[model samples]
Target: MKAAKAPQAPEPTGDPAERLRELKAGLARAAALGGHPPPSLIAVSKTVPAEAIRPLIGAGHRLFGENRVQEAEAKWPPLLAETPGLELHLVGQLQSNKAEAAVRRFDAIHSLDRASLVTALARAIDRTGRHPLLFVQLNLGREPQKGGVAPEGLEDLLKDARNAGLAIFGLMTVPPAAKEPAPYFALLRKLARRHGLAGLSMGMSSDWDIAASLGATHVRIGSALFGPRG
Candidate 1:
């Protein structure tokens, strides 16, 4: 035999209760490490169907994350009307053209990286007269392909965003995949403190512990919370 081929991965079965419990457990463990609750859990429901989210809604998770503006624009409206206060957030790179639709759709935009995008968002807000929460995405790992302002460039881009009338609430980041996230998480907390921002959206299912302890006001956990999306 081929050495039993390493136990096959579990199937998701599309049950939101299981997802909710998994998230709650991770949060509980993170909370146990300290005297407080994990800040906020933004369930990344990017590929998750709105039907799957019904159970999470039933289970009392009100905030969900979506990657693309068009996808969210298509999915969230009915869910929002049905759930009567559900907040959907745009957690991916947003384009300038989609800014107005995104402003109308999402309660928050987590990946505010570019000054161009910031200017677009401000213009969109002026068009719609709605101010969605914005977080400056800092490319902490400085990955060449990542879509965030360089850490060294954050303040300058933010100054421009403010000058353009964007309501920046805090910062967000994705540290180098594995390899000890604590230091990076701590760095985000330091920046938030220095700027006096009220939100620090860091960490995920894997490293939320480090993030929470370091003062992350929001944690976006996808896999450990919802299992694989595919």
Candidate 2:
């Protein structure tokens, strides 16, 4: 007998609001398939300008992800000031020197992958009196060029984060490109379970449904919501 196939998620089409609806429905269906709660969607607004993001914000999308500290600082502050309850997330590599700036601006940091970063964030948190939710990024594919901590070094990083007073809320991973992502998502889920971490920040426009079904708590979506960048 042929095995049952997983449901394919619908492609997000139309305007931003309609796209958001489709994406949310797809995520809900994926969550049902996995027997887990629907994951939070972080509409990745990295290079998209404020004009483009306003519609989603008007449609009640409060969580957004940015790649750089400078860009976020330039774009979000006024928008966030006008729209209360908006949560900005830093979804790219964060330099230790920018820890203070990151702590000040973002609501969650998804790239806490090294000892120096942990120490820097800890000091920044203490100095600013702000505590953003943190995620330990794991280099599941063991890519040298990536920003994630190696699987073998994750425990040590976690230990350092904890000792430095940073509360690690989850694990995040970017699967190797040009390949299937489900296995990586499953591996991340297993790693989180082993470490007693509750959140998994995996998935993107291409494989978010797979990530959701495998137990992702936060899915970072860019093109699906905002269209392709220039």
Q: How far is candidate 1 from the true structure (C-alpha RMSD, Å)?
A: 5.1
The reply for model 2, stretches above 4 Å from the true place, is: 1-9
Where model 1 places Cα greater than 4 Å from the true spot, the runs are: 1-15, 32-37
How would you encode candidate 1's per-residue C-alpha lDDT over 1-230 as one tens digit per residue? 23222221123344667766665665666665765566788888888787877888898888888899888877888888877988877888888888888998888999888878888898889989888889999988888988888888988987998799777899998887745677777788789889878888887766776677667778886776567769
User: Where is model 1 poorest over a 10-residue stretch in terms of lDDT?
Assistant: 1-10
Best by lDDT: 2
TM-score of 1: 0.88
Residue range with the least summed lDDT across 10 consecutive positions in model 2 = 1-10
lDDT of 2 by residue, 1-230 (tens): 55334333457899999999999999999989999999999999988999999999999899999999999999998899899999999999999999999999999999999999999999999999999999999999888999999889989999998898899999999988765788888989998999999989998988889998998999999988998888
